[model samples]
Target chain A: MDTAQFNEALAHIRRFETMLVEDGALILKFWLHLSKKEQYKRLKKLEKNPHTRRSVSKRDWRHAKLYDQFVKTAEQAIRQTDSGEAPWLLVEATDWRYRDLTVARTVLESLAKHLSLESAQSEITTQSKPLTPTGTLPSTLTILDTVDLSQCLRAQEYSQALETYQGQLHRLAWAAYEQKCSTIIVFEGWDAGGKGGAIRRMTQAMDARLYRVISTAAPTDEERVHHYLWRFWRHIPRAGRVTIYDRSWYGRVLVERVEGFAKEKEWQRAYLEINDFEEQFAKHGNVVIKFWIHVSQDEQLRRFQEREKIPYKKHKITDEDWRNREKWDVADLLVKKMAQLPEQTKN
Target chain B: MDTAQFNEALAHIRRFETMLVEDGALILKFWLHLSKKEQYKRLKKLEKNPHTRRSVSKRDWRHAKLYDQFVKTAEQAIRQTDSGEAPWLLVEATDWRYRDLTVARTVLESLAKHLSLESAQSEITTQSKPLTPTGTLPSTLTILDTVDLSQCLRAQEYSQALETYQGQLHRLAWAAYEQKCSTIIVFEGWDAGGKGGAIRRMTQAMDARLYRVISTAAPTDEERVHHYLWRFWRHIPRAGRVTIYDRSWYGRVLVERVEGFAKEKEWQRAYLEINDFEEQFAKHGNVVIKFWIHVSQDEQLRRFQEREKIPYKKHKITDEDWRNREKWDVADLLVKKMAQLPEQTKN
Candidate 1:
């Protein structure tokens, strides 16, 4: 390589090793020295041996001739790239016993030190609870209380409005396909909220082949073994497609927090983790949309009772739903807290 | 937010969801709709409720007044971002039962389809082995046979040379520290090669605080649970330092291949895996150096015998090392094979 290329290569190499070391790797470098006369004497002996004569190729002879230049270059490399993290050792190879013993002693000492460090690190386990958004909620007060439940559309107006919007959505979906733009939509809301209904209306307008709907439930055996987001990550749509999530990663800070599935630290970290997860899509030019549907406790209760009376809907209302219903106020508090960004809810 | 800010927010949200979907998340989006008159009626009712009266803020009334513009803007957002992967669903909230039932059924059907697809994916298990560089070495012909053992350095010459190199290394290491440069060096050599001796010589020259030596051994339980490189990544040196690896990642292709520790598929992947590991270091401006020490079988055996005669060195001569020595010819073939690039080694 030329001077520039050589320097570039060295920089690249230094970067590679630094990354490894920073990640907790220890590196060792060693070079054994042999003088020109010593090397020539060794090669001549190899040529004299009938068994090894064939091994003394033209390249070996050429390399031998370039020994002085090679030594200079190697020395330059050692000087330029050597760092405190990865030091190079030059061994005088004239004495076999000394060379081997020195290397062995270094290896033993380093191993002992590394192990000691590892043990010390393991002893340090920080048990401090992460600081999260702090605010006490009155049982009757929540953001959901602000939504006017009386809002409704007449049948005639509803059909007309739905038709108009659906048609527009269908055209837009195709446009996105042509542009190769992907979209993701997340729906998180009350158990009995109209989340599913809203999703159906949108999907009905688009081509059936154009979109996919994901309904997140309890973790499966496989999902339980991995991260909470692992199951969700398995269904990401290809470009120019749609993937709708009935529920999302928000559970970590919501239901999981309420139910004690995620510890204080894990859920506290979720805010940043969730943001990071979303940031990836933004970087990739993909579209994301999230919606929260709210329903009053009375409405939820009414829906739960109606479901129990209906055969098809009965299957949807589980004992778990009833159990979760009792904690509605707590869930409401979590919802409000999760909605605010870290800065917005510092206290 | 203003028009441009609103658009930017929408774009950001879209990208976030898109990323989640791409990672296998199924996203669902839903919006509940209410007419202006209905919204006003609901807010008025809430204002009369003693428990919820305090929740009706000025913002709520202001939002009610912006209903028309809000609807228009929501429509704009839906149209601009609607894609195949993540579709939007709008539900008419007039009838509670209708809204709840539609959403529940859509969720049920979508989940069924998603589960079926997941099962189908799991059924596909491709077991094809990766193609690696291929060549055969005759037992009589090996790379180790080429090293001439006759080369030796005089005691005076060795001492002078060692001092010069050590002094340069000490200076270079501190310079590296000042520059915040990092380096990783890997040593792979024959059982009784001067790898240790070479490493000791270099470490002695550098400040004790400047460099670290990592001796790679059998994988720990933690490492076994992760990628093969996990053990090494755990010891990455900080900036302005050195890390030396005795018996580095190359063991995947060298001893692991010969010893049957790694399967064919795993060893096959190591070439790419190792390159990727180094590339990370290079990208981060860290230096990486790998050294291979070669020794004739006669010299190695002579050293092994000498070590057995010495009290401290005797501990180093284990059955594993002796067994390994018996496979010198095979090891030679592997060393040569590994040294060649894929293109050079390809049959």
Candidate 2:
């Protein structure tokens, strides 16, 4: 109800409208305005008629009394939300015929304009070009290079540290439960970067009652019908619980972007949508943590081979995985773009 | 909420769970139990640790005091909502290891069962068989037969009646807008039955600001990804607004049923789903009206030929319309089923 909340809502609605328009929706909003005097005249005339009198409720009278204030507030909202993509039309409503005709004409014109450009609109060139790892990019010194591969933990030390950390995590999960703070953990990684092992360790530390691990694979037939984020939203954690996503919404910008599964506009707009979504978590006092695990190409190859050699793990290595291995430039773009997202938008 | 509202919510949730399971989803619900003494002890211990003390809030102590009440409420909820499709598993949670292991084991078993039956599930026989006009159903005395085609309006009288009715409807629309009552009009009809013509007349009568005419056609790529109902739900009328649908969700049971676009189970399940959806409209105090226009086969053929002869109306008659003419039994089943639906369900 406050100005800040109202303004933010207006911004959110405008963002949605712009996104729809960019995606080729023909949006035309109209506000049929009645003059305060004309509105009063119509109300009184309806009140005089027994059959129509019941229609004019107390709320209508109250609205009529505050018509000027209502108009002012509406004007403010309209001004803030107005956009070239989905422009608002203000029509005078003294004559019902004129108002109806005007609105219908506008609708017809918008539809016709949309239909005429249908073929041409399909030829819009995507702005995103594939990242070429050679020449335009450095041969070395990537964000992945910052991970010191030589770092290792001895078995005895690893066991001790793991127990201590796990114990702490178990206690923290309970404490968070007590405070009604739900948590979301998003995992993104190279195909063979040991995400499953890391997730298993994390889940092992927490009481199963307190967390749900959702392994994001391909979209199911049901999920395919909704927006990509719909499936993720459907499984949001309840209060005092945790949801861990193995491969999260960042797929739009990472794999989908590189693999051409998502068009440039879709993946690009997803950056803002994701930020807005995370903002909801913040607003609700929930905890969100994300991770990106990187493995060198040689290390990935080693793990892929190790998986193939194992009887139970053979299914983990697919032809798609082998195909994805050729896209090193994807990792470069993903790392850089992901690192910059928080800086570029309000989260 | 009142007891009635609470009970209705529980029933709604159980219904949703049943639908999901029927659609081949494997669902699991769990309740992790802890004694009041154990909960108090844990809270006390956490509060004593500086690292974890910050996580224990006043709400935790309040909840501890209401532990018995919470347990009773939980029991009632569990009793009402539990079903074989998604049964709740209660785990004794004094031991974290046992609780976590129990949950993980249950999940594994459910997944294993689901995966094992993947191939066998696809062989499910659809219950619905196409109706033949020849023998099975009565060849005459259909619901459509009740309509007297001999009834006709004089041109002069028709024009006067149209103006009078249109004017009354226009006034009523504004009245509904003033009273904040939304109206949803659903039209289901055979091709060349004047659904478009009727919708156009209705919209012409109402203020364009107060009504939107949604001409339901084949699902767009975006819509095809969602449930068949998704497109219908997307254009729901706002408060005081009227949404006139030229074709409607009844297509699931009508065209999709006879045409086999939706399997028997899908269409059969839609009967209940559609009722529940309309129940929401009633709950919101919105107005809903439905219409089915039928034209005799000979009359339909005459109109088809007449339409084809006119250049402007040529697009109105398509090959699909000519093809659908072969399925008179669709109209028969549609009339009987649609007529029986309200009586069969708690609509």
Candidate 3:
């Protein structure tokens, strides 16, 4: 943990971030600091036991050798790179009483930031953008409307329909894989707007051999080091396979942008950057599907409250939701911007 | 390479695979190897240039001290963990030319193996077992029967329909991202069976913000490690995002199983394993969509012949296609197996 190496790592991080943005990705970082005393205690325990000792790397011991330098370097990195588009949340990990609470709150806040951006961007696309004649459909119309939901398949209509679609998609996906086709799907909506239900319904019908579901939340340590998009890029489906996102990269515009965690330029440019990315995807022959579930804000409140009341769903709610509820107007403005973009404008 | 350590890695991989089976995830692993001679060449190159000098590690300079030990360990790891469910592909890299060709063939063959298994399993579910109702629609219906091709949302009629769906899905995918939902979609069909057409249609309508397409062809040096399924798993969609596979995981039954690249048991159990995996996906609320474009064998032949006559499509007529054509009965048997499985069994 020589201060020089620490500073150099920070520089490396900055350069890495620039490259990520150039490549159409963003990053959010965090630093969890356990006090020197606490680290020493943990080190002592490990030293006392050979079993635990094996897991401790020589690198760890070296890091411990210069704890102060490590801390100072981490602090410098945080200070230098933390910004609206990519912010760093520092956690004091000494007191157990405070650590969990602080970490959870910060994570909740970050998630809120990301989710709000999603909400805002969705609102913009669905609400502000006027329908175009080239290929764009009216915003009010639902893809479901095209389906003959009323034409009823059977007693097990949902299951049967799900199976039919999943089976065909599975096979088609494999064929695409043979041809090197990559797939990405997006889902968004008001709270508890059946996004999860819809995902389960669709996934339940396919062969798991060809697909996988990834849930995104707060960034982990390794994730923090890379750009936000880096983590997501890491999840890109190989050619001919499916990669689904419950929530995705739009967080810059919807959550981070609206919540002031990201500057206007950051989220504003994301619309174009995202379009460029999709252009690449299309060029590669990826089958890209994006869905937004619509529900009244009142429905969201009901679900939010319900989540608070349910033990299992309790994990779903956070104080930040309450805070976000208060900033609907700000969020709405961002949504309008998202909606104003052309359907397929290349960044 | 050290045979013991090689076996240890192999053992670790097998353990990981078993764990994934019970956990409903596929464990894919990779081993990257280059011979000592090649390594020396690289080191020599690096040492010869001022800029490339740092590429040589102290470890390389002291190879005499470690090479024998390392090789022995690596070999041992490889042998110990090779299993029926997950086996290792030994890439002989003494000759770069041979290695490249071998690796490419191995990848294509490996993919075929897994896909054929999926196909066979589906066939068993659809044919061997009772196609009894577990509540979903029958697994044999064509996409044309279900989707309203006649009631077209014409270019001018609610022209924004595609964009709307894509946008909505985009938001939904991001929401899933926040929630960390995993999603997968697969497409399978004969060549010219509208797999590419359908995928293009889907992509044309999607918001680029939330989706990506991955095209699978021959594997490069990087992907050969890990199990065949590892690369696919790496792309699992984060919650709310979707991945579409033009051709997907069914290669086991359709290609590998038919071609004799995989052992009987490997492809046989993929059905149950696949089902278990899908069930886990459903439990986790990720969506999976599978598509199989059905075309008569005559249709396939006509298309294959057409590829030979056309300059652009000529590349599509591979010797393997002709080889697979010779084993139509075996291929059909595997396809039947794939058709037999119920969505409930897998999803």
Q: How would you encode candidate 1's per-residue C-alpha lDDT over B14-94 as one tens digit per residue?
A: 765654454346666778888999989889998997544645779999999999989999898997677767778788877
Clashing residue pairs in candidate 2 are A225-B225, A225-B226
Could you give candidate 2's per-residue lDDT for residues A63-105 as a string of tens digits? 9999988998999999998898889999998998999899999
DockQ for each numbered candidate: 0.02, 0.11, 0.01
Q: Of the candidates shown, which would achieve the greatest DockQ relative to the real structure? A: 2
lDDT of 3 by residue, B1-347 (tens): 36564554455456557756543343334565776777777778878975446446687789735767778866766667666566677776767798778777777777777778777866664322211123123335433335442353568655577667766664555456557776677888665566877777677655564566666654443455445565566776656667777666577556765555545566666666566555556656677778877666677788888989999888868887776566654555556557766658343
Off by over 4 Å in 2: A1-142, A154-187, A195-257, A260-290, A309-315, A329-347, B1-140, B154-186, B196-253, B260-290, B305-317, B329-347
Q: Candidate 3, B175: how far from true, in Å? A: 52
- Please provide TM-scores, in order, for all candidate models, with all chains considered together: 0.36, 0.66, 0.32
At residue B169, give the lDDT of candidate 1: 86
TM-score of chain A of 2: 0.76
Docking class of 3: incorrect
True contacts kept of 1: 0.00
Name the lDDT of candidate 1: 0.78
> How far in Å is the alpha carbon of A181 misplaced in model 1?
1.2
Per-residue lDDT of B1-347 in model 2, one digit per residue for the tens? 78898898898888877776776678899999999999999999989987668667899999999999999989999999888779999999999999999999999998898887876777676556654554243444545667788788999999999999999998899888878999999988778989888888888888788899898877776677666777898899998999999888988888777766787778779889888877777677788888988777788889999999999999888998888888876567666657655542233
For candidate 3, the TM-score of chain A alone relative to the native chain A: 0.53
Q: What is the interface RMSD of candidate 1, in Å?
A: 23.4
Best candidate, TM-score: 2
Give the TM-score of chain B in candidate 1: 0.61
| Model 1 alpha-carbon miss at residue B146, Å | 45
